[model samples]
Target: MSKNLVEVRGLKKYFPLGDGNILKAVDDVSFTIREGETFGLVGESGCGKTTVGRTITRLYTATDGQILFDGKDVTHLNKKDSKALAKDMQMIFQDPYASLDPRMTVEMIISEGMKIHKMYSEEETRNRVYELLELVGLNKEHATRYPHEFSGGQRQRVGIARALAVNPRFIVCDEPISALDVSVQAQVVNLLKKLQKEKHLSYLFIAHDLSLVKYLSDRIGVMYMGSLVEVTEAEELYKNPLHPYTRALLSAIPVADPKEENERHRIVLSGEPSNPINTLAECKFYSRCPHKAECCKAGLPALREVKKGHFLACSNADALYVDNQGFL
Candidate 1:
């Protein structure tokens, strides 16, 4: 098995509402991203998927728990240490347009990391910027242009180049393709795959699109209201989703075959969503889970392995209790 490049244990990120309330962004989330593997995190908006990625890359200070990167505890690093850590870990923001500074040209944006870490001299940095531009499918001529000159897809490629500038081993892809057009999404995804294979990079790919996640991820983690409900190998997750939220998420993916689409049963969840503000120590999906029982309110269901390599968090222990035509 490949060694883990990133290990997040019992990670928590809470934001204060200033009214004696706390917004539990990430609550005790734990997972690992192996070297050269893509760990996809899929969830509805406000489920804390982005926060988890940010916390892992040290963009956000973790409220609690440990973040281990390459066997070192990086949960809380000082400014100097954090700057050093940046070369090993980086992030590709969701919005390519907003992520890049309009005042700077593409060359400046891509070479910023190299300059920050003083990884190379000015001449070497310029050559590296041109090299990275070509690596990301852009030309050397475009280096002088600003971000606004390119389309969404082109700008995203620039973002990818920027992330790779420092030769990071692990990257947090915070919905990198969500803002792009449908036609261009595939191009960006393919570029990422190529880069991963060439560089042996690990990724924590956070997204709301289950289909895209399925296509790109080695393992998939389903998050619900600041907690992971199901985790398994990509194909295995689609083949057998143990958690109710996972099933619902899988069912929501539109099918290409009209017959299969028509016949497939959709798991429409009922009931109000659980409040994230200082939530009780219980299942977050309890409010909207169709398979939820009275026993679900007893206590928080910790994420535990049900079968080999397949983990789930549900109070209902009956593994055979699959619904909606065995989740189609």
Candidate 2:
């Protein structure tokens, strides 16, 4: 079995909205990413996908639970340890334009991490920056220009170079390609895959696009409200989705064959998601799940293995099935 590079156990992040109200962003989520593998996370907007990434990278202090990086608990590291930990973990933000500083040139942006970590001499750092520029499909000439001078895809490349400067083992990619043009997204994703193979890196790739996630992930986890409803191998997830929410999500994907597309039936979820503030001890997706039972409202369902290597959190998984007519 491959060793897990990162392990998140019962992770929770709650933001205080003031007026004695707390917004439950990530609640009791757990998963493991193996070394050199990509673990994809998918959900609708405001479903706490980004929050999970931020909390795991220690950008936001987790409200509860444990985060273990290479067998070391880092949920609350000290200043010295946190600084040292930076060399092994990094993040690629969703918005390239907003993440990069307009005033700084690409060279400066990429070398800042090296300078902070005191990795190499000035001459060596400059040479490394040039190498990284070339590695990400940009020339050394582009390094002298500011972020505004590059296109959206080029800016994202620069972001990738910056993350690679310190030679990280794991990265949290928070929708890194969502802001780019449809044509450019594939190029960026291909570059990331190449880099992962070359560097033996692990990634927690968060995105709302299910097709893209399926293409890049070794395993996929589906989130609803603030909790994970299903997790399994990428191919297994598409072939056999047990949770009602997972079935609904997969039903929305468009097929290429005209005949199949016309015959497909979409599962329309009724009612808005329940509020996340001070939520009760009940299933978060109970209101919207098509196969919801009275027992679902009694308490929260624990994630359990429903089949070999496939985990699900639902009280009525046994009764749910997909037939020729559709989900029933």
Worst lDDT run of 10 residues, candidate 1, spans 319-328
Predicted candidate 2 versus true structure: per-residue lDDT over 175-285, tens digit per residue: 999999989999999999999999999999999989899999999999987899899999988887778887878887787789999898989889777888857776888
Cα shift from native, residue 235, model 2 (Å): 0.5
Give the poorly placed runs of model 2, Cα more than 4 Å off: 256-258, 321-328
Encode model 1's per-residue lDDT on 51-80: one tens digit a residue.
999888887899999999989999998889
What is the overall TM-score of model 1 with all chains considered together? 0.96
Q: Name every residue pair that clashes in candidate 2.
A: none
Query: What's each prediction's TM-score?
Result: 0.96, 0.96
Candidate 2 Cα lDDT to native: 0.91
The residue ranges of model 1 lying beyond 4 angstroms of the native Cα positions read 322-328
The worst-scoring run of ten residues by lDDT in candidate 2 lies at: 319-328
